[model samples]
Target: MRFYRQFRAYLVRRKVWEVTAYLFFGILTTLVNVLIFSVAFRLLELPWPTSNSLSWLVSVIFAFFTNKLWVFHSGASGTRSTLWTLLKFMLVRILSYGLDMLTMWLIIDAMHGNELIAKLITQVLVVAVNYIFSKLFVFADSNSG
Candidate 1:
């Protein structure tokens, strides 16, 4: 109860309900990725990395739609404007993906850290990066100075 009260206070103070919603949708995206990967690799007997790549692709598409419509409520209108915003979103995600790989390599290989711990740290960094890029670049209001 005390923890819940403290969490609620933090949410009210920060007004970061979007972060909460993003996390909710992120979980759904993870589930979708895992389900697709499992079906492709185990049931359909696809190649090892191919299944993973396909799953990631589908999940990214799912995430783009959900984040634009639900999480950030992007105001980009017109086909060109929307496409531009999507391109920015994809670019940011691609950059973050590179960062994730670099972080994992630095932590696990260079620093001799555990793989799971390195991955967790990398994921946290990626989430922060994605949120910042999405808010400032992909979803920023064009009219705002």
Candidate 2:
């Protein structure tokens, strides 16, 4: 009960509505990723994994900038710190992306479902995983990069 009060105060003090807004931006970014990958893979005859990675790389840049400026409103860090943040973001995402691929591979290749359908399911899960890590880990502040 006491801990709950402290948590509520933290949220209120920090204007946690801003977090919600950031998450909304994340949702849009996720849509952008899916759209890019789906179009490139399905319509443009690009390979599935290739399209997925390329889309993620592009969207990560978008997500990073928005998160730095709007979500956390983090002050400018030196180049090393900025690079570290991006590195951490990529490292955190690697496992989640791998899991997404495994799931899609299992669903589409093993189970013989549609690849596009499997991608849709994986996209939803990956977006949530990324959002949590991006907020709590990648963008976390520290004296050391």
Candidate 3:
């Protein structure tokens, strides 16, 4: 309980703008992911998993740059630090991508391939998971300024 309070206070002191900027980055990536996935699947006749994986790959490429500059602001003092940070970034993304795949599977299989609904459902679930993981794990550093 006290930890949660301290965390909230830390966020507030850092300025809500930081949080807003991070959210905006996530929203942009999610929009692109869903747009590409839906368009490719519905109009271009791509398979569900194929479209989902491709869209996620595209979003991840964009996310790497955006998060480095905006979300984490990792000074990354040297090439080694940069590489280390990117390793952590990629690790976080591995889990995020896995969640995305699993969510799509549930939507497609368990929910019966109602694509319109499945796309929307999986997008929401994956975006929330990505945001929480990115903020709490990927971009978390005491000196991430």
Candidate 4:
């Protein structure tokens, strides 16, 4: 119990708690994306691109709220400020979506790779990219203006 408390204190002191929370939520978001994609592509017999887009839509919405409330703890209030934050978040995510599509196209269409494999790989890349964008631009304190 003491060791656990010490470790927890260290994590907080080092500001790793925020990252740990982000990673936890990021995993959940990824699971949501992959599950939605799998259902749309395999069960519903949708095309890879369509399935990918559908999954992206759902995951982005999930990510936004989680990131705001938990990950970054933006604590942004007011209708205008919150809406502005949402808009910026969506814009950056749209850019990442384009990257996702391009990566999928290159892997599955051009390289003749497996669609599921392509999606998993794309998710890894997209998650990293999104984290950077969220930290630097979307959820950044300066951008709160």
Candidate 5:
């Protein structure tokens, strides 16, 4: 029990806790994206692009709230501040979404590769990039400025 408490305390250290929380939320976000995309693309016969966009929308919304509240602990300060933060988050995500679309297009459309495989690859890339952006830009401490 003592060792377990120490381990828990170690995990709760700032960077460690942030990363662990981000990873947990990130995985949930990925699952949300993949499930929506799979259902739309494979089950409903939607085009890959449309399905991907829809999935991105849902997952981004999920990610923003989870990332803000749990991962970074960047709780809303005021309406304007929260809106600004959300705007920045969306802009960064749009950049990553472009990357996602381009990679997916190249793999599934141009290279004639598997859509699901391409999506999985894209998720890994997107998640890494999003973490960087969110940590450095979107959710950085407001008082740091």
Candidate 6:
């Protein structure tokens, strides 16, 4: 009971609910990506690489909206603010995706680590980077105007 209370208090104090929401929506976004990939590649007979790229594009757009509205509750109004936020979000995601790929390469190829373990570790790092980027840079300048 004491631990639970302490954990709850910490969550509230640190606004961890935003992280929780982000994760939930992130999972949904991933599922959407996978589904699109499967449909495009397996069902529609599209090339695998093309399907993968399309899925990634769709998922990133979905993630941006969900993270902005549901997770961060960004108050930056106006069309310019929205477009600027989106550009920043895309830039940060691109950087983090590169970091994730590099982490995987270092862990798996250079270190001879197991593929699944390397991917899991890379994902953790990616999530931390993404959260920090989203919070501190991407959605940080909302003026509610």
Let me know the TM-score candidate 1 reaches against the reference structure.
0.66
Question: Which residue pairs in candidate 3 collide?
Answer: none
Give per-model TM-scores: 0.66, 0.76, 0.77, 0.90, 0.90, 0.66
User: Please, what are the lDDT tens digits per residue for candidate 2 over residues 32-116?
Assistant: 7888888888898887778878777777777778777766665548998788887887787788879777987799778988867
Tens-place lDDT per residue, model 3, 62-119, is 8878877876676665888777877877787878778777877887877677765776
lDDT against the true structure, each candidate: 0.74, 0.75, 0.75, 0.90, 0.90, 0.74
Cα lDDT tens digits, model 4, 3-82, are 96787678778878777777889899999999999999999999998999999999999999999987888867889989
Candidates 3 and 4, the one with greater lDDT: 4
For candidate 6, the lDDT comes to: 0.74
Single out the weakest 10-residue window by summed lDDT for candidate 6: 115-124
Off by over 4 Å in 2: 1-15, 142-145
User: What is the TM-score (0 to 1) of candidate 5?
Assistant: 0.90
Give candidate 3's error at residue 138 in angstroms.
Answer: 2.5
Could you tell me which 10 consecutive residues in candidate 4 have the lowest summed lDDT? 136-145
Error of 3 at 78 (Å): 4.1
Output the lDDT of residue 140, model 2: 65
> Tens-digit lDDT track for model 5 on 7-99?
657887543867777888999999999999999999999999999999999999999999888788885589998999999999999999999
TM-score of 6: 0.66
What is the Cα-based lDDT of residue 99 in candidate 5?
A: 97
Error of model 1, residue 77, in angstroms: 1.2
lDDT of 1 by residue, 10-124 (tens): 8757887677867888778767866776788678888634665676578778888998887787788799988998899889888876786687679867898864466456656
For candidate 3, the lDDT comes to 0.75
